[model samples]
Each structure stands twice: as structure tokens, then as C-alpha cells.
Target chain A: MDNEVLNTEPQPTEEVRVVMPLVDILDGDDGVTIYFEVPGANSKTVDIEVKNRIMTISAASSLRRDGLPVVFKRNFRLSDGADIENITAKTQDGVLTLNIPKSERAKVHKIQVQ
Target chain B: MNMLARIRNAEELLPSTLGGLHELFRSMLDQVTDLGPEWLPEGSAAGRALTVETSEKEVTVKLPLPGCESKNIDVEVIGDQLTIHAARTEVKDENDKRHYIRRERSFMDYQESVLLPVKVRGHEAKASYVDGILTVTLPRENPGSPDSHVVKVD
Candidate 1:
């Protein structure tokens, strides 16, 4: 009843325009993986950038309606130990997965006892 | 230094300086809570934007459930109410012993019911899950039926 409208009518605008997609960050032996939910976004519409140790993610969705917009964006700061040069990203089923490897010096190494 | 977790706002969480993220986070929650009254369940796996579009013939509802498998999703319609239940189980690798340091995304057990503005053919309603977006289309019960008529007065 709140959003019901006829086909000929235009989509009602929402009070809030910008939205932040939900995210999940996990750590592993190799590195860390981050997941962002931006439905309706695909490889072609997603954009990822890292500058000055700040990583920014954004995507453009095909569907637009009240309380939701066509664009999605988020930003993150890389850790000192993260290997920015080796960061990789992929978008699947509206979720963006980014993997950031640890730098060589940052990896833990066990020293042999003499 | 530890790598920061993903922040919902466009602003990155700087280690030393606590940025003025209060307003941004407040706006984010406002956008989320305004989706619908019964659109989201408390402590749901993930929050999503729900869109309802109506046409002359049918009413369509779209909800995005990322990381969900098709088998775990269930769609049911009774009368003018439509219910969607979906779950996404976490994948735990046998050899991977590493635990989640900051597990933000995992199981998505979602259950929500919405009331349709117009009567629909519950039995004939069709639903499809494509690219993480579940679209349910219900045909109107009476497409061309007039709701009101003017009586002729002599």
C-alpha cells in the first residue's frame, strides 16, 4: 500500500537518496576478503580504485526506485601491511569481492632454533 | 597496523582520526528503515532495498539476496499476502582452519511478508531468482474490472 502505483505513473522519490551497501570483511592466512552487496550491479558497472591508500568502490544499478538509487559507492583505507599492488576484485551476483594480499615483510615467518 | 573493516559510509575509517561519521551513518540507517514496515526482519542476515512496481496486468516485487542459493529460497502467496523466505549458508572449507577475524557477511536467513495493494491470482503468481535478485510477479485478479460506477438518475 505504501508504494503502490499505476504503470503510467513515475517512481516516487524517497527522502534519502544516497545509500551505503552492507559489507563483510574476513581475514585468512593469505590475506583478507571484503564483500559488498550492490544488487543490479555487474562487472561492467562496478568501479574500484585505490589512491593514497584509500580504496573506493562504486557501482551503477539498472533498477531504480523509491529509497534506492541507481548508484552505489563505498570507501576503505588500506592497512599498512596490505599489498595494494596485488589487490584483486570481482563482481558476482551483485556482490563485490576484493582480495588484498599481505606484503612480503608483513607475512609471519617462523625462525628455526639452532 | 591492522587493515580496517568495510564501513557502510563512503568515508573510510581512519585509524588515528575519528572522522565525523555520525551524520553519514544516521542517514544510512534512515534509508534502510524506510524501505517498508514489514519488509525486513530484525537481525536479518543482510539488509536489502525492496522495490515494488505495478503494471496494469500485474504487481511485481523485487528483493536482492546476495550469496543465496536457489534451493534455499522459498516463495509463497496466500490471498493478498506474499511471503518470501531465503537462507544462505556459510561455506566452511574442511582444510581452512582460519576463523573469521571480522565476519560481516555470512548466513542470510530472510523472512518477510508484504501486502499487495490489489487482489492477485495467488495460484498463478510467478517468481524467479536471477543474479541474486528475486522477482515475484502476481497477476491482478480482475484486470479491467471497474471499482466504482456512476448510477444513471432519471
Candidate 2:
């Protein structure tokens, strides 16, 4: 048997890279909070805007000296009726925190007999 | 002659005593040799960092942001996505006479993103910054179904 022919079996190709953004969400009585791990981002480079009941957050970080590539870009789509009027947010230590307050009508209220 | 040889060969067929003993010994030896301090302790500081929780009704995010100011931070929500961005630029004052042994903290710029569980009405979202921590509140969608019709009794 020819050595080359015997070793000519097909080899599998390497898998493709997939980047997924890291995010965490917390639920509270008043509203929900969201946390994101974004390193090397600043207030000026970040933009958060709400239009027609949709909230979008975008940020870009400066390149490092070593030219390390960014890991992933993530976007979240929330329900339509979410109250964005009273939304609050902050970023520090590479962590992004968001607090979303529930609307008054959404909150459960007890009814009293007249 | 052939029949006798065949019968004798069948009677002598028996299990070998040392079979598989070498492999078992090798495995045990490998395990004993690979034990060390790093291998012994795992997940020692697993839960020391900040924790985040989210649900369908609302999205709540918490982070441990120390030594940061609210003025240096910016929060925005577009569609269902919530973003928080903070930047701190510290310029060393050389004019003032000061003795410094070590300066550890450098200029830091941080940004993060969170995905809402439900569609957040951007107009109704609220945001607040306090101390070093930033919190964003996104309300849940209306519980009542959008597509509802009242039926009249015939």
C-alpha cells in the first residue's frame, strides 16, 4: 500500500468564531435593572437614546497600544410597553448599571370599598 | 495427531494474571503525581464580584463601581437596549509640590450594555446615578393583550 494514499483521509475544518455580548438583568418590585460588562468605555464614547418607545445603547472604546480586538457587540430588544420615562443608568469600573422603574398603572394597587 | 493437538490447546487456554495491571498502575501513578496547591483549591473566590438579576416584567442591573463620580458617567436607552458609559481623565498637577511614592490608579474609561427582558417604552424609562454606582430602571410591557375584542351576545 502506498503510504501517501493511506494517509489521505479528509480532515475536518476548524469551527467559526462567534461573539456574544455579556449582559445580566435583575427584576425588582418597582422595576428591573440591567448590568453590562464593557471595558475601556467612557461617557463621551457612549450614547443612549430612546425613540418611539425603543431604547438603544451604543458605545465605542479606544484602541489599545497592543491592538487587541474587541470581543463582542450585543443588543437587546425589550417589550413595547416598558416605561422608559423614569429610566436611570450609570457606568463605573467597566460595569454598566441600569434601573428601570415600573409605571404607576402597572403597579398593583388595592381597591377600597366606598 | 491433529485432533489431540487441538484438544490440548483448548484445555490450556486461560486468563493472564498481569493483563490490564500495567494500565491501572499507570493511571494511579499519574493521578498521585499531578496533585498540587493550585489543583487542590478551585472556585475559592467565585462569588466575590457583583451579581446581576433580570426578569420578564423588568430589568434590574447592579455593579460594584467604586471611586467614580456621577458627573463622569452617562446613561442612555435606545429601543430595548440600555447602555451606561463613564469616563475619568485625571491630569497630574506638577506645579503643586507633592511627594508621591506610588500612583496605582490610571485614567479609566468604562462602558457596559444590558439587554432588557421585555420591550421598554423609551419614553417611560428612568435613570439615576448616585455615589459610584449607576442604576437604570426599565418597566415591563402591558399585561393586557394588544389584540382584544369584546363579543356581543346574540
Candidate 3:
């Protein structure tokens, strides 16, 4: 029995970490809607800026006991034909929402035949 | 003949009380080995309260930052990845004679990182903070596929 048990040694268990992104997007006729899930994050701890057709969002979280340090980061750029001025955003219920209106030229239009 | 006699004698002289003890030991070992880490929550630590999700058309990043000012939070995107970083200091009132039994929330600086699925045009991204959440919108670049061509047959 001892020899048989020794031959059937149990395998070591693996440690797995779950890393989930905090964002969602919905496309619409006029613009696109983007959603982000940020719990305990306030407006003061976040920065939103648009420069040279680039939009940047960054924030630092408050540290707690036995908590890992915050290293959250993300970046994105706009398309050439995108309309940046009509963009709007809001945050509520630990979720961020942004509306990006399409440019006039980018909107689809039907032509009437004479 | 002497070895066979000793083996038979030991078999007949086994302790009767060890049966229950052996069963208990087996149960304990089974319970300990069956315990898994899945019982714990994901990202269940202080100072790290953010989840990021991305798609081909846009990238959304969320952060849970309570008692933080919206004006202090900053969101930026470099290349194809998005970065969210913010900092704030909490000032406790010394006059208040409030006793705390337990505290789990964090009160220090924190930073989080999110990798976008598609390449985003940084110049056109937008962000907003309404209640306590921060949402960022990044428009994807066009694949620039060629227009369909017409064919004529003779």
C-alpha cells in the first residue's frame, strides 16, 4: 500500500489571477457610447485631457491594508475623421460613459434621384 | 514457521480503538486537500479598485475612487494602451472622538494600468466623471479597406 501510494503522488495546484478590463463601448448612428467601471473613484482622482487628437484618462487610487499598489493605465488615439468637439462623458454608479459624435461627413446620407 | 506465527499474532492483536482515529484522520486530510483558492474574490485588495474592458471600436476603463475629487483624476492614453493615474490625501479630524472598530478602505495614493484591445486615436478620446466612476471613450482607427471595384463583361 505504501509503495502504491508513493507511485500516485498528487499534482501541485496552480494559482490563477483574474485580470478584467473596466470598459465597454456601444456604437450608435450619431455617436458611440463608452462605459467604464471605476468603483470608489471620484472626479478629483481622475484627469481627462484631449491634445492633438489624443484623449487621455488617468487616475491614482487610494491605498489600503494588504492592498497592492495602484498601477492602472490605458491610452487611446482618435481617427482622422473623428469629431472631438461633440464628445460628452459622465460617471455614475462606478461606471463611466462617454458619447463620441461622428463628424458630419462621416454620417451616412441618402441621395434623391431626379 | 516462526515468521508466520508472528504475523498471525500481530494481526489478531490489532488495537480496536484505532479504527475511529484512522477514519477521522482520513476525513481531515480529504477536507484540507479539497479546499481551493476559488473561494476568495478577485482583486479583493485595497488601493486597487478598477476594471478595464475593451473592444474593437472603443476602450472603457473604470476606477472605484470614493471621496475623491473629480478635478484631481487624470486619464491619458499612450500608443495603444490606456493609463489611469490619480492621487489624493485624506485629512482626519483630531477633534472628533470617534472610535473605529474596523476599517478596510484605503486612504493612500494608487495607480492602475489597462491595455486597449484595438489601436486608439489618442487625440479624439473623451472621458467624464459623474458620480464616483470615471469613463473614458477612445475611437478606433479605420482599417482603411479599399472600396469595392466594379467589373464589366464583354
Choose the strongest candidate by DockQ: 1
Candidate order (TM-score):
1, 3, 2
What RMSD does each model have against the real structure?
A: 10.8, 29.0, 27.9
Candidate 3 chain A weakest lDDT stretch, 10 residues: A12-21
Cα miss at B107, model 3 (Å)?
4.2
Instruction: Point to the candidate with the largest lDDT.
Output: 1
TM, every model: 0.71, 0.33, 0.36
A2-98 per-residue lDDT for model 2 (tens digits): 2332222222123211122234454444555655544445555556665543345554433121233222233332332246777788866544566
Report fnat in order of the candidates: 0.27, 0.02, 0.17
After superposition, the stretches of candidate 3 with alpha carbons farther than 4 Å from their true spots are A1-114, B1-49, B143-154
lDDT of 1: 0.63
Per-structure clash totals for the candidates: 0, 48, 81
Tens digits of per-residue lDDT, candidate 1, B16-112, equal: 2445554343322211111111212231222365767777789899998877767888999999889999988664467766445445454468898
Q: Model 2: residues >4 Å from true position, as ranges? A: A1-20, A63-72, A112-114, B1-154
